[model samples]
Target: MRIALGVEYDGSEYCGWQSQPSGGSVQDALEAALSKIACSDVRVTTAGRTDTGVHASYQVLHFDTQAQRPMNAWVRGVNALLPDSIAALWALQTTDDFHARYCASERCYLYLLLNHPVRPGLYHGKIGWFHQALDVERMRVAAQMLLGEHDFSAFRAAECQAKSPVRNLTRLEITRQGDIIAFELRANGFLHHMVRNIVGCLIYVGKGKYPPEWMRKLLEGRKRSDAAPTFSAAGLYLAGITYDPKWKLPHFVEPPLAALLPRMSRPGQSGCNMKIR
Candidate 1:
């Protein structure tokens, strides 16, 4: 039988999502806990593999198990043995054809950054920080140039294992409240370090290091070194994953991304909404 599970985790302490031989990765901790419940070796497949210091509000995975414990055992029971930073949110029986990675049609990521004169103390590892007054308008203008299908090699990490650099970006939205700036992005797919690199370039534009038009130039150049450095992984979140209705997953309807969104709202706010879809 196959079981689909939704997971949430704070990735600050773990090495990353994939299982590591050293046994410190999030996958290592999860599989150990789940195997105890199944009474057999348990290996799971995830919708996305997040990097160290990245977080996940909604992540999906599937594993095959001959053990016939109730769904609650997979959720509550496995969670009891798992580390406090990781928890299984829900579990459901699904078709064998369903896959956590391939079935996912879209992926959403969020980045929360603190822009102020002083470095962040409270959100040290939970959010990114920059010590300068950023021009949100300029960042918005630069972000728009990233929408639609394009070769994102300019933002690709050198160690990325992806076969292609071309990806369709469906949405890119930036909003701000006080010193907190939020970037919400959705895409059919993302290369390694793509989102963080994009954020870094936007920051460069916002800080007057480059003009908004420089974004289009970088995209066309398709040279990773020509673009801005990759931003910190601390603020990155694997917020949502969408699949077709046939999968019958909860996210088949509306994804639960809204739950992870930053709700920092203020009226007549100069640091406000700038979205491209």
Candidate 2:
């Protein structure tokens, strides 16, 4: 049987989302728990592979298990075996055709900036809080330019192995709450490091380090060097994934992202809007 698992994790404790050789990872931890439950090794496929120190509030993965375990059994069993850093929020029975990665119709990411005079020890690993004060208004203006189909090569990490860089950025919004600055991006797809790199460029603009219009030029330029530095992975998270209802997976929603991004009329779906922030 196929099982879909909704996972949430604090990426600070692990190497990354994918299984690693030298260190621990969300994949390694989850696989360990699943192996214990199934009494056999299980390999799971995720909707996205986040970089080291990147977090996920609602990441999805699927694995094929022949154990005939009940959905609640898999959920309770995995949670029992897994550490506090990672969690299997829920498990659902899925069709053989349902795939967590390939079947995903959209992916969303949120990048946070701590704009203050000093970094708060309270949010040390959970947020990307910088000492420099960010102009959230300017960042919002700059983020709007990225709200359409484009070749996001400039924002992609050079090490990214994706075959293409073209993606439809359905939404990009910047909002501020006191010292917290958040960049929310939704897309039909994302290239590796796309959200972090875009946030880097916007930060430059916010700090008066780059022209406000430079982001649009950089997007058109398609040169990776034209973009800003890749922002810290601490602030980036796999906010959510969208799929057709036929997938039979429950929405793994989080409160932080729910209040930050614009909510659509339907759950686990996005509306067709191109207007930027």
Candidate 3:
């Protein structure tokens, strides 16, 4: 049986998603837990591989298991054996051909920047705090220029091994709430560190080092050196992913209309449950 698992993790202590010789990885810990649960070796393929210190709110992975255990057992068993930093939220039986990575239609990432003289106590490890002041409005306008299909060679990592630099970016949003600046991007695909590099360029625009109009010129240039330095990995998070409805697991039915209905209440009223599925 093939099963899809929803995951959340704090990447602070691990090396990265892929296993490495020097240190532990998210994949290593997960596979170890799975092996213990199933009493057999189990391997997993993830929707995306994140770098060291990069977080994920809704990452997905899939694995093939023997027909002995229930899907819920796979979830609970793995969670029990896994460390507190990583979690297996849920597991649903999937089709034999379902692939967590290749089946994804789009991926979204959010890069957080805390631009203030001092950082917040609660978000110390989760965010990048910069002492320099940033102009959010200018960053927003600059990011819009990156909203369509383009050759993103300039914004990709030098070590990126993607076949092509062309990608369709559906959304690139820059917004600020108090001193927290966020860059949200959605794309059909992303090259290695593509979003972080793009955030670097937008940061330059916010810092008055790069004009907003310069983004268009840089995109056309296609030179890797034209973009700003890549931003830190600590601030990046794999926010979510979209898959074709047909690829959704069999037992996991979409929520019913009654459950999907939204409530109308005053702004401060408390009974609200917004579920995205």
Candidate 4:
């Protein structure tokens, strides 16, 4: 049977999502725990691979297992052997044709930036930080320029192996409350470090280093060198994966991004749970 699962992980300690021979990747740890549960070696495929220090609130993956164990074994049982940083949120049996990566209709990412005169204390690895005050409106304006289909070569990482830089970015929303700024992006697909690189360019515009119109120029340039440096991976989160309802994915949690908004200030911060879809 093919089983699909929703995962939550703190990627701070691992190298990335792909399985590595050294066994440090999130995939390696998950496969290890899963193999123990199945009593055989197991391999899995993910919707997307997050880089090191990048987190995921609802990462999706699918694996074929002949071991006829109950669903809880795949969820709670595997979690028991796994490290504290990784968790299995929900699991459901899926059709053999369903693919965690290819079946995905869209992927969403969330980035948190703490803008203040001093560095972040509690949110060190959880968020990106900048010392200078950023102009949120300017960043918002610059972010709008990134919406829709475009050859995002300017924002893509040099090592990105994706065959095409063209992506249909459906959403790029930026919101701010207090010193914390939230960026929510949804796309048909993403190039490596694409979101972080765009965030870096937005910050440049926010800090008055360039006008909002410069974003269009960068997009037109198609040269990675002309764009701003890639932002930190610490702030990045694989927030959600969207699949067709025909696949019947289980409900994740009470609300989206709940696992990630922990570092928010109280009296509470508004707009932290920005819509992903």
Q: Order the candidate numbers by TM-score, best to worst.
A: 4, 1, 2, 3
The whole-model lDDT of each prediction reads 0.87, 0.82, 0.80, 0.88
lDDT of 3 by residue, 1-277 (tens): 8889988788888888997776499999999999898899999999999988988777889999885788778788889999999988788888988899999888888777767776546555677666788988898888889889999989988889889999999998776655666677899999998988888888889889988998998899998797888888877888787888887543222222113123322234432233424
Residue-pair clashes, model 1: 0
lDDT of 4: 0.88
Clashing pairs in model 4, backbone N/Cα/C closer than 3 A? none
* Candidate 2: tens digits of C-alpha lDDT, residues 1-277: 8888998888998889879886498899999899999999999999999989998888999999899888887888889999988878888888889888899998888776667676746566777867776777788888889889999999999999999899999998887655667678899888988988998899899998987889889988999987888988977888889989877678644324443323222233343131332
Best-fitting candidate, scored by lDDT: 4
Greater TM-score among 1 and 3 belongs to: 1
In model 1, what lDDT does residue 248 have?
A: 78
What is candidate 4's lDDT per residue for 1-277, written digit by digit as tens?
A: 9999899999999999988888899999999999999999999999999999999988999999999999998998989999999999988998999999999989989888888777867667888988887998998898889899999999999899999999999999887866778888999999999999999999999999999999999999999999999999988999888888899996443226544555464244443444433
Candidate 3, residue 191: the lDDT equals 93
Q: After superposition, how far is residue 142 of candidate 2 from its true place, in Å?
A: 1.1
Residue 237 miss distance in model 3 (angstroms): 0.7
| lDDT for predicted candidate 3 compared with the true structure | 0.80
Shift of residue 34 alpha carbon in model 2, Å: 0.2
lDDT of 1 by residue, 43-147 (tens): 999999999889988899999999999999999999999999999999999999999999999999988887876775655777788888799999999999999
All candidates: TM-score: 0.92, 0.90, 0.88, 0.94
Model 4 residue 236 lDDT score = 92
| Winning candidate number (TM-score) | 4
